[model samples]
Target: MVEGAWLWLTLFAIGSTTILTRGSFVLGGEGARLPPALQRALRYAPAAALSALIMPDLLLDAGAFDPANPKLVAGIVVALAAVRSRNPWLPFFAGMGVLLVLRKGLGW
Candidate 1:
């Protein structure tokens, strides 16, 4: 019961932070304008965050990295496609396709 209490509190904290971080602008109304440089930098935050989340999975594992990890290779392929195509959602499918092909053909 005591251990579970901390887990519940942690979940609550995470949920609260997620809501607040995402909805802060909505809550603040239309009067705010961040400085241009800050806004430009902040625009990249999501991509930076996503890369941060992906890097460990791409680059590391329990023992070490496996360059043959299909996910990482697929991610690179998707990233390059996204760069070339400049379409937001297409890379997702490309990456998925890469992973599926690698998994099926190479058994990775």
Candidate 2:
């Protein structure tokens, strides 16, 4: 509603939401400990979010789904690396390397 720039407004909204979300856990006491079933679901949250973020890029082909794609292959490789190792940089480099090889070296 203000006459300020869009970027500042966006940043403010993000920062405010972050504070509120973080504060929920910080303020909660022993009552906040999640139940077993809920904790099981929470365990998969990261994978679910990652899939939501990555699936479109891997599955989309010129705005449509294409089952056979290099990006999909590389993404799977990266996911495997992440699942196997605690080190963060390895998966990143693995994904980046696969993309480079597919796009530059193999021309596919």
| Best-matching candidate per lDDT | 2
Instruction: Looking at model 1, report the run of 10 residues with the lowest lDDT sum.
Output: 59-68
Question: What TM-score does model 1 achieve against the real structure?
Answer: 0.58
lDDT for each residue of candidate 2 in 1-108, tens digit (9 for 90 to 100): 655698798889989988886787787654777679987988898899988988899999899999688898898989899999999899999999998999899999
Residue pairs with colliding backbones in model 2 are none
The local distance difference test score of each candidate is 0.84, 0.87
Model 2 bad stretches (over 4 Å): 1-4, 25-47
How displaced is residue 10 in candidate 1, in Å? 4.9
Q: Of the candidates shown, which would achieve the greatest TM-score relative to the real structure?
A: 2
Q: What is the C-alpha local distance difference test score of candidate 2?
A: 0.87
